[model samples]
Each structure stands twice: as structure tokens, then as C-alpha cells.
Target: MKIKTLIVDDEPHAIEIIETYVGNFPEIELVATCNSAIEAFQILQKDRIDLLFLDIKMPGLLGTELVRTLKNPPKVIFTTAYQDYALEGFDLNAVDYLLKPIPFNRFLKAMEKVFDGYRPINRQIVSVQTDQNKSENFIYLRVDRKTVKINVRDIYWLESLKDYIKVVLADRTLVSKQKISVLAELLPESLFLRIHRSFIVAVDKIDSYHSYAIEILGKELPIGRNYKDACRQRLQN
Candidate 1:
């Protein structure tokens, strides 16, 4: 799917470079270009901008402020020369942050984030599929044709095997040959979250979290290198 995007940066050369790079991707279509956040905001009000390539430093307003001002902002990817704003970017759930003087490969990664901005493709988009036919809170585990019904609440944590996942519960671990990404959606969002590419854990099930791992039922699970901050914040709350 083509992503309609906007570029908002103070530097004319920076905007030119971005426009040139964005032209390289078949999936990306530049919708608007603005030198300031206010101009971008006006454009956003009139156009359907799907993604934003925002710059941190600008004359009247900072890029982060522009994002905060929007009631329903599009997906944002902060573009800046300084690496200091990385924490702020993630706090806003930015798709990805692009360092200034963006190389083609790095730009490619940012473009790929279009996939990440939304839900993982396999899981159905949440909707009002309610009432008599409410979505079941259980997933069927293929246990040799005798499918076992596993309640989402019972899942404490899951570890990735070479070809499957070991669903760790208080009682016992059940084996699931499902991708962690897909299984993530099957569970309740408030209860479970993907702390790593390989691990999924119940938010409420966490007993104590440390700098390295979270201790659950005396079992410690390694926090994925990049996902530590998000997990720590969530666990603390």
C-alpha cells in the first residue's frame, strides 16, 4: 500500500534531500512539504497525510509540540541531526526516528515502518464485532487434531523455540507453533504485550522487574535490548 507522507523541516536542502530519497520508494508518495510546523498543521488539516517526517528543531515550534497539538496525528518519524531526541520520539510511539543526512538504506528502514505503524497484518483490526457473537478470548492450540482451548488469561509468558513457542503458565507450559507476532494479537492487549521479538508476557503477571529481566514466579526473562525502556515504563505503571 502506498503511504501518503508529509515532510516538515526548516532547512531547504534537508527538505530537498528528503524529497529526493522519498521518491526512491514505490510505497511512498510525498503529499506535502513545509518549512515549519504551523504550515504542516494547516496542510494536515486539509489533506489526508498518513505519515509525517518531522524535524526536531524549527523556528516557532518544535516537532514534538506539533505532534502533541494534533488531536489525531498521523504516524510520525522524527528527522533530526541530534540523536538526543530518541527517547522523546519513542515516548510518542513514533514509527521510527531518522537521523539527519539520511542514507538510502536508513530511509528504506523508515519507509518499512509503514507496516509497523498499524497492527500486525495477520490479526484482524479491532472493531465492534460485539453482542451475541463477541470475539472469543481463547485460541485453539493444535494438539494433534484434538484442539485444546487455551484461555488468554492463563498465559503468563512465552519463550520462542526454534520452530514454536513454549507458553509458560502458572500450572504448566503449553507448546504453540505460532509466530510470536500473531499470538500477540490473539491475547488481551491489557494483559499481554510483546517485550521482545521472542518473548510475550502478561503485564499484570509481572512480580518484579530489574535492569536486566523481569522476575515472574522466580523465572527471569531477558528484556530485548531495544525494548527495555518501554517495558520498564509499563511495568512501573
Candidate 2:
């Protein structure tokens, strides 16, 4: 099923940019654009939204307080100009946090979260057909309503940005618009390991490992303190 999304911001230009960007992705449906946290509460009362792009600041109510009131909230991607709210935003377990003047590349990465089912790599998707006999370990993703098949074996690493995760593959990277925790759940346990809040690595693709970082495909990924145990165990065994 396509994920339903809402864009909440006080800026018209930022709202327009996000709406246009979301329009390009077939997987995301813009349910409503809320200019204030109060409006978001009203929207929530009516719609069964799957995702939210929320602004940190607003006039009547603060975005942070709005989240606290929700009994069950759709995954949220915080949208704001202020960088100071980053820590508080994550404390509430927001899916992703985006700075203003949003880029298409980054937005596209966020859209990937809607379709990454996080099943086994061998699973068959309606769009990208995989042959079980070929020993090609890959998965097909339903993105923008179009199915694209990706081989897990080709992945160099995974990077997390607030609510988005980028899969660095050999040919091209795929971005899943989701949290690091969600991606960690969906990717295969045997081939992938969470190295940090913003990073994951393909076990076989590691080029080097150091006290502070891991090198993969010439890119270095750091180890988040929250995830160090799993990463260290993976390296040891």
C-alpha cells in the first residue's frame, strides 16, 4: 500500500517545495499541508495518515507538544529551519528530520521508506522479478508506484539521515525514507549490521575497521554509541 503523507510547515515556499517534491514520487500521497500545529491536530483527527513532515515551530502549539498528545502517531519526519531542535526531535522518536530548502535527492531518499518492506533479500516483488536459481541475492522495491529490483549483494553501505536511509550500492544507491531503526529491522541480518544511528554496513563489503569508524567502498561510516555492541560483536564473530 502507498504511504499517506502530510506536510506541516509555516512557510509557504517550503511547503510548496515539499509538495512538489512529494508529487514526483508515486509512492507518497499528500493528504494535507498544515501551516500550524493546531491544523495538524485537526488533520490528525480526520485522516489516517502514515507519514508526517512536521515543522518544529508554529504559533499556537509547538510541534514537540503535538507529538506528545498523540496516542498513536504516524511516522514523523521533522521539518524545520532551526538545528537546535534536533536532539529533542529524536527524543520523541521521529522517523527523520529535514532542514529547510529541501533537496530532491534527499527527498527521494525519504520516499524509499514507504516501500522497503524489510523482508528477506530473496523475497519476490511484483515489479523486480528475481530468480532463485541464480544465487543473486536481491530485493525489489515498490517506489513511486514503480517497482525497481535491487541486489543486496551490490550494496556498499547504508547511511541514515533523520528519517531517511540511503543504500550505497555498486551501481547506484537507493534511499528509503525511513528511520535507522526501521531500516535495521528490514535489511537482512546475515549480510547487514547496524554500525551507528546513521550507518549500516554489508558484512562482506567492509574494506577496513577501526576503533572509531568502518570503511566501505572508500567511504567511512562511524559507530553510534547506541549500536556499538552489535557492531563489535559482528566484527568479533
Clashing pairs in 1: none
- Residue-level lDDT tens digits of model 1 in 117-222: 5544442211222232233455545444334556667778987886677888789878855555545545666777677788888888888888778878988888
lDDT of 2 by residue, 1-237 (tens): 466888888887677667655655555668889799899999999999888888988888888889999999888888888899999999998877787655444454555554454322332223322243332354434345555556677777878767566778887877655455544544578888877767778899898987788888787888887877878888988
After superposition, candidate 2 runs with Cα above 4 Å error: 117-237
- Go through the candidates in order and give the C-alpha RMSD of each one to the true structure: 14.7, 13.0
Q: Model 2: how large is the Cα RMSD against the reference? A: 13.0
Best by lDDT: 1
Whole-model lDDT values for every prediction: 0.75, 0.72
Worst 10 residues of 2 by lDDT: 119-128
